[model samples]
Target: MNNFFEVENVDFVVGGNTKVKNMSFSIEKEGDIVCLLGPSGIGKTTILRAIAGLEKIKNGHIKLKGKILSSEKINIEPENRNISLAFQENSLFPHYSVEKNILLGAEKNPDNKDKKVSFNEIVDLLDISKILNQYPHQISAGEAQRASLARSLLSKPDLLLLDEPLSNVDQSQKEDIQEKIKKLLAKLKITTIIVTHDSYEAFLLRY
Candidate 1:
């Protein structure tokens, strides 16, 4: 019954319109994957953004592991929250190769650098080893999505928010990628929330 992540009565407004109102939810356990299923423009992505500190919550609070991240009176900067949000849009640095992009935001602490997973290990886990030397523009959509996902994972966030993560993945590769990602996240014991429109995928993930 201990909640590790909590969103309490969060309200987000855009241009005088309430995009997200009175929303409350919690993730109670480490490595628990929660899927938000709803139609587009229903504030699902907005909720994720609010939790990650990308969007300001007009009312109420967001907390992770008992640390306050967002509230009406106080807001932590996105970078300091230690939460990584992978958008539906490809966020890769165009000039960086896939290998460089994935490692760009990794933890820089020298003390535990050896403990972190290596570039080769992540690329292999995401099944993106073959495209490591290629640029963002040189890769396919599915490949770019995989690389972006890898980049988010490399940051070693306390919480991970994925917005329609598998949208661009090929249908044939979707299930396999999902399984790999699910297994990897479980192994890392990272609390994650994934936003997707497909109910079937959500059911599969939640089950």
Candidate 2:
């Protein structure tokens, strides 16, 4: 398969001991949704962190669409990577209003002056128009999760990394959010990666 992502002969070590040794893999092709399935603390999120330029790799390289995203030889910064990430917690700005956070891309990026999903459209899609004026704390975890997804989409992400995006939600609330995620992701149609232990949620993400 043509690769959208490629990690070759990579090795990373963090903290005093956490290490991923000689790891190599690739996304099947462009638009392929893949997951790194393992128990917690298995360097799953670390892998994503490496890909997102949030962490530095000790060795080897990461290429997205044939452009090097990261490597010890050439480390690219996170903002320059075109990768939007929504981790389980601390994904949104607590100080900014939901509308403001969603439109941050347009604010930082003048080139996106004509994005298809305008601020209003994103708020409407996530049913967050009511909370557009609310801070991250004012909304429910589920609502914030949805809003975070919307914000990521608004960035026109080249690759979207969801690090267990729904882990903070209650079990009963998970399916609803999971469905919303599937629908929203399907609409956005980008190269998406989900980090989670929920097999059911994984099934829902089986696009």
Candidate 3:
């Protein structure tokens, strides 16, 4: 049988240069975590963006659970794709508390009756219960990253694209966060693709 998720011959261009040229890969099972590793400016993040529908693909296609998401003839809107992307910059709402910020994601996906976890379950799973009332700037980089992750996972996305998930965390906290995230992804069984420049971090995320 074929894999549950696939990216076939995807080509992405930024400016005039080709970033991801004919890239292809797949995840064979649910709850599997995959990592894309490369040097800076080598299109790792670009691939994730393309898979999440944030960037348009110039060629080839991306499929989730055997459904086509992007191609030359068809393109699905980001929100309608049941895909979520969490970037390295920590795109949290400074005006909203952590709980409120995450709640927004859960609200958007109310149509998804397949969601197996509740909002409070996600917050507790991410260990952000203590900082639920804190604003973005009031929390540490690690805390902010966790909150952003919680927001993404709360939606119970079919595909989770994490661009440098630990980039905002301190070096000392990378391993702990990576382990926690790995466990949570496995528990939730949300197919995930992670982009990272650190080889050690990639190794730590091994299933």
**Per-prediction TM-score, please?**
0.92, 0.86, 0.89
Residues 89-201 of candidate 3: C-alpha lDDT, one tens digit per residue: 86998899999999988886777665566877777666789999899999988888888988898878888888888787777766766777788788778888888998888
What shift in Å separates residue 128 of candidate 3 from its native position after superposition?
2.9
Kindly list the per-residue Cα lDDT of model 1 for residues 60-88, writing each as its tens digit.
Answer: 88889988889989999987887889888
User: Which pairs, if any, clash in model 1?
Assistant: none
Please give the lDDT score at residue 7 for candidate 3.
90
Candidate 1: list runs displaced more than 4 Å.
Answer: 108-116
For each candidate, the alpha-carbon lDDT, in order, equals 0.83, 0.76, 0.83
| Candidate 1 CA-lDDT value | 0.83
* lDDT of model number 3: 0.83
**What is candidate 2's lDDT per residue for 109-150, written digit by digit as tens?**
446443345667667655678878889988888778877877
lDDT of 3 at 32: 88
Q: Best to worst by lDDT, what's the order?
A: 3, 1, 2
